[model samples]
Structures are given as structure tokens and as C-alpha cells.
Target: AQSVTQLDSQVPVFEEAPVELRCNYSSSVSVYLFWYVQYPNQGLQLLLKYLSGSTLVESINGFEAEFNKSQTSFHLRKPSVHISDTAEYFCAVSVNQAGTALIFGKGTTLSVSS
Candidate 1:
């Protein structure tokens, strides 16, 4: 079985300020992890994914996440965030084996203000 947790339920920041949303996962077998973002009035979309090879992955919009196997963590970070960055961020994990389950965190709401 696998589980995901988003440490902070809400993160408020000013525009252009750096921010981070922490995520942690646990699984008995190999798994693939991803981050998804949900903008206000829009559905969720993929932000970044960690499949294999490098432990670091990034989104086109300046968001980045480093998968740390030792810590079982995949925390998302942005050096400079804009107001548009405000949204709900979700951390999800899927087991590699067939019929395995996909789990998602409760989600963290990031509120970026001007």
C-alpha cells in the first residue's frame, strides 16, 4: 500500500516571493510520483513528474521538485512566484506494478497575493 501527505494545508505568500510546498510519500514497492496544480476556476493539470533517472524534475512555469528517495519526499519549490501561482497543489503517487493503487495527498492551497 502507498500513501501521500502534503505537510501544509495552506501557504500564503506575496507575489514574486519564493515558496515551497512539502510532500512525502511511502510505498512498499517502486512507484512514480507527480505534482499537479489546480488553478482557481480550472481543473487540475500536471506540473512535474519523477519517473526515473534524475531525481529532479521541473515544470515549464518555473516550478521544480526534487525526488529524495532517502527521505521519501518530493517537495515542490519556486524561487519567485507570481499571483497567478495561487492555486491548489496536489501530490500523487502511483505504484509501478499493475493493479497497484494511485494515491493523492489532501492538497495544499497556495495563495499568492500582490
Candidate 2:
């Protein structure tokens, strides 16, 4: 079984400030990493993924994360956030094979104050 842990449940910051949301995971088998963002009252959308080849991945909206195999962590970060970036972020993992469902962390809500 695989499990994910998000260190922070909520993080508040002023607009245009930098932020980081920590994530760690453990799996008995090889897995793919993903970060998804959920806006208020909406379903999650994929932000980025670490499938293979690269340890670092980035989202279009200025967020990035690195897959650390030794530490079993995949932490998300953004250099400068915006009010529009306020949302809940989830770190997830899925086995490399089909028929395995994605498992998610509880989530970290990023509140950007203007």
C-alpha cells in the first residue's frame, strides 16, 4: 500500500509571496508522482507530474516540485504567489501499472491574502 503525507494542512501568505507545501510518500512498489490543485467548489486539476526520466517537474502556473527518491518526498513550491493562486493542493501517487487508483494526501490549503 502507498500513503502520502502533507505536512501542512493550511498555509496563509500575502499576495506575491513565496510558498512551499511539503509532501512525503511511501510505497511498496514503483509509483508516479502528481500534484493537483483544487479551486473552491471545484474538482482537482493536474498541476504537474513526475512519470519518469526527470526528477523535477513544473506546472504552467509557476509551481514546481522535485521527486526525491531517497527521502521519498515531493514538495511543491512557488516563487511568488498571487491571490488567484489561493486553493487547496494535493500530493498524490499511483502505481506504475494499470488498475491502480491514485492515493492523495489530505491536502494543504494555500490562502493568499491581498
Candidate 3:
């Protein structure tokens, strides 16, 4: 069975500080990884994804994640975070087959303070 693990349930960082939301997984078959974020009082949004081609992917808001095959991980990182970055982030996976459901991690809450 494949599963995604988000070790850190909460990450509190000051404004303009660096942050990394850890995400790891175990899978026997080829899969696609994604990071989803939900802002305050809003639905979940697709932050970034890794399906094929490059192992590393980035979002417009200066967030990036790398797909490490051997390590079986897709950790999201940002050099400097802003107060606006505070939100709930989730790591998700999907099988290549069409109409497949996505498996998501517990989710990590990022709290950015000024």
C-alpha cells in the first residue's frame, strides 16, 4: 500500500524566515506528488505538483519542492516566508491511472508571525 507522511503537524516561523514543510511517502509504483495549501477561510488550492519531466517544481509564491525518488519524499521549502504564507499545507499523491483518487497526508499548519 502507498502512504504519505507529513511528520510535522505544525510549523511556526517568524516573518521573513525560512521554512520547510516535510513530506515523505512510500510507493511501489510510479506516482505523482502534489502540495496543496488552504488559506484562512478558503478551500484547498494546488500549490505545486510533480508528475514527470523535472523532479523539482515551484509555485509562483516562491515555494518549491523536489521529488526525490530514492528517498521517496517531496518536501516543500521556501527561503523566506511572509505572514501571508500562514496556512494549512497538505501533501498528496495520485496514481497514473485515470479517475484515480488522491491520497493525502494529515496536513501541516504553517503559522507565520511578524
Residue-wise C-alpha lDDT for candidate 2, range 1-114, written one tens digit per residue:
899999999999999899999999999888999999999999999999999988989888899999999999999999999999999999999999977799999999999998
Q: After superposing candidate 3 on the true structure, give the runs of residues whose Cα lies further than 4 Å from its correct spot.
A: none
Give the range of the ten consecutive residues with the poorest summed lDDT in model 2: 52-61
lDDT of each: 0.94, 0.95, 0.96
Please provide the root mean square deviation of candidate 1 (C-alpha atoms, Å): 1.2
TM-score of each predicted structure versus truth: 0.95, 0.97, 0.98
Q: Give me the candidate number with maximum TM-score.
A: 3
User: For model 1, how does the per-residue alpha-carbon lDDT over 6-55 read when each residue is reduced to its tens digit?
Assistant: 99999999999999999999998889999999999999899999989999
> What lDDT is reached at residue 73 by model 1?
98
**2 or 3, greater by lDDT:** 3
Model with the higher TM-score, candidate 1 or 3: 3
**Model 3: number of backbone collisions:** 0
In model 1, how large is the Cα lDDT of residue 54? 92
Instruction: Give the TM-score comparing model 3 with the true structure, all chains together.
Output: 0.98
Full ranking by lDDT: 3, 2, 1
